[model samples]
Every structure is written in C-alpha cells, then in structure tokens.
Target: MRVVLAEDLFLLRDGLTRTLREHGYEVVASVDNGPSLLRALLEEKPDVAVVDVRLPPSYTDEGLQAALEARRRRPGLPILVLSQYVDQLYANELLAGGDGAVGYLLKDRVTNTEQFVDAVGRVAAGGTVMDPQVITKLLSRSQARGMIDSLTPRELDVLEMMAEGRSNVAIAATLHFSESAVAKHTASIFAKLRIAPSTDDNRRVLAVLAYLKR
Candidate 1:
C-alpha cells in the first residue's frame, strides 16, 4: 500500500520509512511539517498515512489536525497516528470523527514490527487499532466513575481483563469462570456502559474509552 509519513524527527522518519518499505509498503512521501504533509496527501492520495502526533512549528496537534483534514478531504483514507505520549483528549477527538479506519498508537509500539505492520494493515482495511496503553488509561478513568460501581467485584475483574484485550476464553481461564459466565458478565458490563447490544468488539472498546475519557 502507498503511505505518506509525517514526522518531524529525522532519524525516526528515515527509520520508519525504511521499515515500511522493507515491509513492502511504498512510502509515497515523508514530510517534517504538517502543512507539507497535507500537501503530500492531496498530491499522492496514498492508501494510508502514518503520522506523528506532533509536527514542526507548534509541535502540538498539527499532525492530528492534518489527519482530520485528510479525513474530510478523502473520507475513506486510513490514518494511523503515533505519539510519544498518550493523550486521551486527542484520542477522543480522533474517535469523534465517527468514521472507522483510524488508529492511535504509541510510537514505542513500532518496535513490535509485526504488530505495527499489522495495525497499519488493519487501519488500511478500515478497522480500528488502538494502543493497549490508550485502552488502559480509558479503563482507569471508567473505573473512577460510579458506572463500574454497579458492577460486582467479579464483573469488574472481567471488565478489567477485557480492557486488557483478553478474550472471553482467556478471561474465563484467568478468573476460573466458564466462558458463558464471562460472556454474561461482558454483556452486563456493556449494558451498564449503555453500549448497544449490537456494538462490535472494536466499537465496544471505543465506547469503553469514551466512557473513561468522560
């Protein structure tokens, strides 16, 4: 797939480009600033764009703003945003856009080459891939709310494991409960969170994140 990379760090940009290329992805263009990155997106129309959360000049949310702009310009273009730090506010903004094919992951996660590449592919395929850290922070915030208070201690344990990306079978084994019981608890947690019964796992994760961010 064709990709445009936006990052201000020279070493990181070069390394990431090399890695992506080695993985068979074409690096259409790499830019150091947000404006130029946006220009490249318009010119290249890459299948996906990998961006750093910070860029030149402001070094704040410029990359994120560019991602938003790209979404507006080409609604189907996939975007994967990497950051040195986890920003719940920024995560909320990205999800607020509504459309899928968006990802927010930590830069350090790039070290897991296979996982990182897989995440890129998932985003390109219009799926969401979020860093586990993002999920942890959101879960922590959710736990603070009285929403979780309604849950039984065992149910809370199940929810925590789910936030950790554990499957029902895994959580059941860990908690010594049957898979059916775990599923029941998961359903209950979803109900308490006001998540629709039809919500997919990824969206459930995002809903959990949103609840935590709230």
Candidate 2:
C-alpha cells in the first residue's frame, strides 16, 4: 500500500517510515506540517495517509483539518490519525465525513507493530479502527448523562462496539456472542439510547456521536 505520512517529530516520523516500509507499505511522502501534508495528498493521491492529530503552525488540529480536507478532495482516500492524547472532539471530526476508511489511535499504539500495521491495512481497505481509549472515553462521557446508565453491561458493550463502527457479525465475533444475541443487544441499545431503528450506518453513528457529545 502507498501512504503519505505527516508528523512533526523527526524521530517518530523516521521510525514510522522505517516500520511501515519494513511491513511492505510504501511511504510515498513524509511531511512535517499540515500544508505540506495537504499538498502531498493532492500531488501523490496515496492509497492512505497517516497523520498526527497535532502538527506545526499552532500544533492544535491542523493535521486533523488536513485529513478532513484530503477526504473532501479525494472522497475515498483513507486516513489514519495518531494522537498523543485522547480527544473526543477530534474523533468526532474525523468520523464526521461518514466515510468508512478512517482510523484514530494513540501514537503509543505504534509500538505494537503488528497491530499498528493491521490498523493501517484496515483503513486502507475501507474500514474503521478507533483506539480503545477513544471508545472508552466517549462511552464514559456519555454515561454521565444518566441515559447510558439505563443499559445493562452487555448492552453497553454492544453500544460501544457499535460506536466503534463494528458490524453486528464483527461485534458478535469479538464478544463471543451469537449473531442473534448481538442483534438483540443492538436493538436494546438503540431503544435505550433513543436511536430509531434504522438500516443506515451513518444515522447510527450520529446517534452514538450525539450520545457522546451530550
């Protein structure tokens, strides 16, 4: 897979490039700032772009914005965002585009080379992979509303997996539950969360996001 990498830290950038290359991914371009990253995306049209959540020129959400812009320009281009901290706001923004080819994880996750490479491959293949920390934070913040408190532990687990963009089959496999059981839990979650029964994935995602932002 061809990738464009954007991170301000030289050591991390070099290490990432070497690791990804070792894993058989071509690092087409490695940039240090948002503007340069954007330019590289436009010029290279890589299969995927791995970016830091914070980049030069303010070091706030520039990288996130660049990733969003890349998605806007190339609707199917996959993006994986790495961060030193968990930020629900950034996660919301990254998934707002409603494209499935997106991932958000903490930078420390890269130490697990196999998992990190798997995440990259997943995003490139039009899938979503969020850090467990991000999912936990969103779930905790949403639970503060007392609404999420209504859910059983299993129901809460189902809802959290849904928020992570997992399919019923995938959640079932992950939780070691039957597909029918997962479906029931998902239905229960939607009812408790007040998400109308719908086949639309984006609506479900929005419902989960609304609960998180509450």
Leading candidate by TM-score:
2
Off by over 4 Å in 1: 109-111, 136-144, 149-182, 209-214
Top of the candidates by lDDT:
2
1-214 in candidate 2: lDDT tens per residue? 8999999999989999999999999999999999999999989999999999789999898888888888888887899888887666767766766667888888775568887888899789887777767777756656446767788999878776776567788789999999999888888877877777666554565557655565
TM-scores for all candidates: the values are 0.78, 0.79
Q: lDDT tens string, model 1, 119-153? A: 78878877677766776655565544787678899
Alpha-carbon RMSD of each model: 3.7, 3.2
Q: What is the C-alpha local distance difference test score of each model?
A: 0.78, 0.81
